[model samples]
Target: MAPRNDTAEPVAAPAGAAGLAAAAASHVTVTLAPLTEQLATYLAPADVQRVREAYKFSDAAHLGQFRTSGEPYITHPIAVTEICAGWKLDTDALMAALLHDVMEDQGVPKQELAERFGGEVAELVDGLSKLDRLDFATKTQQQAESFRKMLLAMARDVRVILIKLADRLHNMRTLDAVAPEKRRRVARETLDIYSPIAHRLGLNVLYREFQDRCFEAMYPNRYRTLQKAVLSARGNRREVVGRITEAVRAALPAAGIDADVYGREKTLFGIYTKMVEQKKSFSEVLDIYGFRVVVHSQPECYLTLGTLHQLYRPVPGKFKDYIAIPKINGYQSLHTTLVGPYGTPVEFQVRTRDMHHVAESGVASHWLYKSSDVSLNDLQKRTHQWLQSLLDIQRQTGDSGEFLEHVKVDLFPDAVYVFTPRGQIISLPRGATPIDFAYFIHTDIGNQAVAAKVNNEFVPLRTELKSGDTVDIVTSPASRPNAQWLNFVRSGRARSEIRHYLRTVKYAESVAFGERLLRQELTVLGLELPESTDIAWNKLARATGANSREEILADIGLGKRLAAVVARRFSPGADVVATTAAAVDEFVAARSAPILIQGNEGQSVQLAPCCSPIPGDTLMAFIRLGQGLVVHTTDCPVARRMRAREPERWVNVGWDENPATHFNARVDVIARNERGVLGRIAAEVTAADSNITHVTMQDDAASSVTLHFTLQVDGREHLARVFRFLRRIPQVQRIVRIKG
Candidate 1:
């Protein structure tokens, strides 16, 4: 870790200077004794004892290790436990938090936790363990996977994420101890994951903290500049808030409302983002200040809002009443930005006592439940339900990479509050579609998604929902996902479902293709083929990386890989020599299964840049190792042009299908550059019912347009249609298929 310069420019800050300062600050600890005493004020004596014992066990298990800042390793867990204690979390969460990192860093077996604690503790700890890997590789693949695992657990029992956020917050706060090069990644993760979780959970306080910490660590210089700007602004704005507060305090007294009003400045990252987004200096950012007004009664909240509006000129389009339609994370506040003294804008948040509590705690309702009339047993049940969800999603999905994507995408910070026609508000991750809304409402609605009504207008399921948009799903028994559904769906559940359906569809399609190919071979053997059975072959096929039998055939069909190669593996002793591919190259396309005409496998076959292949061309396939096989044309100037050069890479390949389905074979047409000539040529193609994929006119500036149409239709005949049709057009020109 290094000391950040906090300058506007990118420069290296001395690491040791920063490390020492952080070491001093980490001394602030809310230990188990005070934490348990706090819990005892609300929980039973037995429960406090249990929590205390859990802490001691965790402390002993993690004895002797030190953190980046040289603090006792116990301090970190204690900090995490203290945060959870604030949440007044249940026994399992508390216990898990105490021992979360033991398994991964200390190599303490999960089985030990399972036996000592219960399966619940072990599971929670395991979910926490999954988060540790995020600190590894900087690759998106690794980060995405790590994010996925954390989210899956979060979705299961939001606590996993809550505990993880606490861990992350402490990390970010002491990020100076980590390498400077590593700071950005940690900051990025914090912003992408932890901050979003705080926002999602309605933990505005934690959200702001996590975001600021990440922003600071990632851009220490920028952070310092921004910090200085904010501090300077605060110093200047003190009188402004005091005046506003005095006015509000006087107004509330006259209105006979009992309220607690607090002035809160915008967090650093929030201010920094606004400045950057608006491209203004910190001083140029006006209206970056806000106040929270906590009232006892809901009625008093409206009264306070009115009094505030009367006190200052209300800024149009800057008011939001979350009380009417609470945020997805159950945040309820009446927000307004008003033009105050000197026409400067000031923002105010109005909320009831309950909302205030939820706002500070975020999703940690333990604090609320402890004081509420609700029974502890009821709280226990909710915790259980939430924690079990992680297990469900984990059981359903095992791919670490995909799991991370789902969490980041599905469990996001921002949210859209939409409604059903009946006006039931539903909160969803931002950028979510009606399809996600449908699934959120009910699985069957998702399975049968047919059409949707957004604000009573029929709309596509893929439409992104907006706050206050009323969404109504139109589903039918006949409605089911096509492969295209995966294209626009935003929900993890929907995506997973679509992928599963597509995989099944492809497998079925592949099975039929494989059997057809097998029959074609057996038929060539002069024996009637028997029906193929058992799905075990598809698994083998997939493991071998072959998709459909055609793909397998295409490999053999193009003579890239010998059919005997696959046949021998799938079924023994299938004829090695008589395959048509052999004739195409060594057979047709290639002789070697893993062949290298030269050591040029990784280089692009780049169609020699001389000839471009259009849709309908006499194409050939070339086998190359690592780069897989490449498709080329028999007469591509690029291919022929290259054959004259590197003759080794010039392997033979013919169309897998005799009348090739579609290919982009280029044709160099020397024509007098004339207007109707291209039209006439295009007319010939239109008449042929084949489409040209591309047209590249040569830059010779000659009167003739060297047209390249990557057209679609049966191979050579398709090209002949363009040639023959053009021949009759009187602007008749000679045409030749270009290959590479």
Candidate 2:
């Protein structure tokens, strides 16, 4: 085998330079022996033996390789496994963690690991492996594809992500050896992506550590300043934190509550984010000290909260009962901010010991699983639910870049927990709408959602839901995902599903149109359109570099491959006829055939809002990527300008001559600024048999006002009638249609 280049571990100082120097001053040394001893404290004899074997194999495989820090490559895997061991993962997870880099760095095959250890460990190792073997067009694409594979692996087995997080955590910890630019890039990615994942998984320790490390790597100066500020603040607030901790400890005991109370300082990154978001100075951010009370039972957690509230007045709107309604990631706690000594706010987190472990370790809280706590099932179920959602998103989003984007949107842990009609808690992204909630309930509900009732009052489908809101969705068989829903829906699954349905419907429609256009052109050449089995169509597809005849036809319809070009391919003997201008004109007329536009078109057809073209107006079409065909009036300056720049993209289109639905038209009416002038204009528009969709006015002077009315009318004739009525009004000075 060719010598494998192992680039998994960065060469930078794994530990911060300050920490390393401090350790050196203390005459401390670290090695795999200490890590092995730590593993021995948790793992059974057989599991320990397996880990030892994994280490030996990894060490041998990476014998010739070294990290940028000039350490044997073997140490990186050992450190990663040590992190996993801290989580007390299963033997398979630890073994996979030890061998995580082998497959990529040492070219060790999955089959080999499966044979040596077991399939589970090998699968975990495979999941951790990158798709470096395959070629990608750009580094971004390569990274996206790698993330996609890793995410798919995680969905299958949550352990994959847990192990991956450990691997990244270690890399981030020692990222000082990497080149400055690369280190910043990695740190930014860690901060943006991995830290959120850790939070979503409920790994609070790793999450905090990841953020701190990323802060240090990305903005070392800012991190040092913040670190110094936090340290100085800690000294200044030591008395305050002590008082609050003592108060909680004293109150809990007096209330007969058995709990472990400790002061929790905010992470440096946390403080930095607060400073940036809230625009506060370090001195102004006084609520940086908090207290955590770990109780023996769930009931005791509530008691602890009550005891603490007795000590300090609870801040209104700051108390959250997450114990009753855990976060989507299965984080359970009673969170409250209390007005402490000197009127400073002091936050408190109260949870059971098991809840604490899960809150910190998240899904990797193996102790909870081992203890047979029912909450473990809840954690697993929630993790699996989110993992399954990834599959659903993946199904709808075929493009790797789009899938990554949707996943990133989901990684943000900020969520609002709402309730369905039946009291089922439905957690959604903040700013999520009724449509997002309906989809989270079920895709069918989303597909058929027509109206929504929040707390028994009807609201728009795009109404942003809030926590504790009881939302009742009214669905209809005739209703489907509105294109407008895309504007308000916040969840990845909702966006992907909506886009997928629209794309599928558009593609199916375009296929039909392409087939018709091709057949019409073929008929013009006196040739019969061949069936799918016809060798001629298949040959034409191959000649056009298309996979199938349908693809060629669809491309023709989409204007990617011209119908005339395909027609020429199928009828090679008609070259002389193709050169004739009249024949080309006939083919063009047949193919164009005035793409009929109704008011209601899917994402494939957009009626240009600039001109507000009605059915009676001459229309032109421009094909936009992903937006399908956009219709505009022939005289629309915006459309004309676009056509001038790219004339080939414009296609002939016309209104259906009698559109069933009313079209929106804009008219400017200059009216005298009078008290009832606006009311009279609306009454006249209503009297003219037109509904005002929207009206905007600007005061041209003290007496004159220009009102822009977006009125719904049948066509140009109806609009003209409304304009005439508006012109007759005594308040109206002049009326004219507005065009782009």
Candidate 3:
């Protein structure tokens, strides 16, 4: 067997005076020799030949191009390919890495690449290529669209992102040669998008490198100052680090556990972030040391942890057993922070060799080792599951910008492990609500989720989930996603699913409402709507430039077109009659009688907050353009002004016999400013079978205050009952509903 080489092949000169002299003397230039030599160790002869052929093709394609550093553009592709090679990617990935930019920059067609290489390689290259041909209104939109395409492609094939990351890594390393503005832009992009992605994939080594490089580029002065501080701290702690390293090395063997132990320092960016986030001084942040212990087996990992704990006292609540419940990214280890000599904090990570490999390489470990170990297989499975979710988000989201937003939400690294009622563990992002947890289990469950219980205690759906909590979702057939869910959901899947359901429901409601309006106008004209197969329907669709009858109706319902105009088009030559006052009254009654205000009307019908209109309140509706209906109380000031300004837009509306959902109503109270006054008022409101959704306080004087409360009530009767209950309180001097 040949010796193993894990380090990446260097494509450029090292940074230093000695390396510069060597480069100047030899006129060092990038060549395929070193990469080919490295490939021979793992790849077949035929595969190596294919990579060489790809290199030649890419070199010719980029013949006259040069990078900002004045190096042949081919060097960039070779460097990316070499980086992929370090991951032990297959031949197709290697070829794709070499030709990734050809389609975007060289105008090489996809078909040509498909003919030259295999279809897989061509597809991989296409996935890495940006969507530059289309025009966008803003630079941010264009970037988002391009990123959306690349990520969707990556969801299908993981190698696309792997190669893209390698490409980005090389560009970042040489970013200093680019313009300062461009350097900052690229650095920001890397920090915001690529670094999180790397961390999400469990490529810790690459993730750390990206953060450090971006930090240096974004804040050069801060980076230099922090570098000096870290170095100074390192020198001061050398003796302590050496002492701990020796203790671990000696103790592990004595405990009959064979392990490789080494002291590790936190990355520069990581240290800086901790200082900023924790608001600690450099010395305080640097006092904590890190170490890694790689054992030969999983059992030995725990044994090694025990040996280390015996040497130092373990800190309370600082231990995490990832080995038992692995991270969503498939990172498995036993991490414990301990108090070392001189009361300094020491953090240790214990894992087996395979676990260590998976932790560092992430999904790439499957190809790097070519082993069927459970750890590697689990890593691949977890990565595939996450990628599949990306596809799900893409399918539900319509806009590229929205898709990118969803993906960015999922790229967060912090996760909390929770459980279902059945005891199945589900990992979600920190601050995730029960809505996110429900969505994580299944989309259908999420759409129908009405309530949830955490640890057998009923909690709000928007309650932030904590690790180890057993969550049981309560679903109902009639329950659907509320638009308010978008405010609290932390997962991409949950947000996308909620938006998709609302959009679908809104469209259907619009179509139905539009049809009703059209029917009423046709009644005024002594005509009836044609059947689906009627020739008149097709004619009306064509004349109105509508794709279908439903589309025309939707336009009318959305207030984009007038029902009267559409009805007139249906019978253009009919004698027109001037509508009489009695006729108008009858028409108004007919239109308003059937349009009942149901609280669960989705986005098509919104109750105007200006009036807090509920059931039993005489209501009027205004169909604003593209926003189906806005219902309001008859006496609302805003509704009155809108009716005066746009009389034609107003529609008569009535409430259903029973509203299915709670409506928000504001109550103002002048009360004594005594202790527990607010609590008593809240208790009274709740006792009246109403929920207080919001509250605000205003000081009227030192001993008197005005309190405002927003309560969720079923209807006018419920509001009356709440008032009666509040009137019973002696501290409440005055109470009245606030109507706008």
True lDDT of residue 501, candidate 1: 51
lDDT of 2 by residue, 62-81 (tens): 76555765555677788888
Cα RMSD to the true fold for all candidates:
10.5, 6.3, 7.1
The better candidate by lDDT, 2 or 3, is: 3
- Look at candidate 1 and tell me the lDDT of residue 533: 45
Winner of 1 and 3 under lDDT: 3
C-alpha TM-score for every candidate: 0.66, 0.80, 0.82
Clashing pairs in 3: none
For candidate 3, write residues 262-363 as lDDT tens digits.
789898898889999999888878444699999899888888888888999999999999999999899999999989978899999999888888899888
For model 1, residues 503-546, the per-residue Cα lDDT tens digits are 54444443343344345444444444432343534544465576
Query: Which candidate number has the best TM-score?
Result: 3
Better of 2 and 3 by TM-score: 3
Cα misplacement distance, residue 216 of candidate 3 (Å): 0.9
Ranking by lDDT: 3, 2, 1
Please, what is the whole-model Cα lDDT of each candidate in the order they appear? Answer: 0.64, 0.79, 0.82
Question: Which pairs of residues have clashing backbones in candidate 2?
Answer: 11-68, 11-69, 12-176, 12-177, 13-177, 14-174
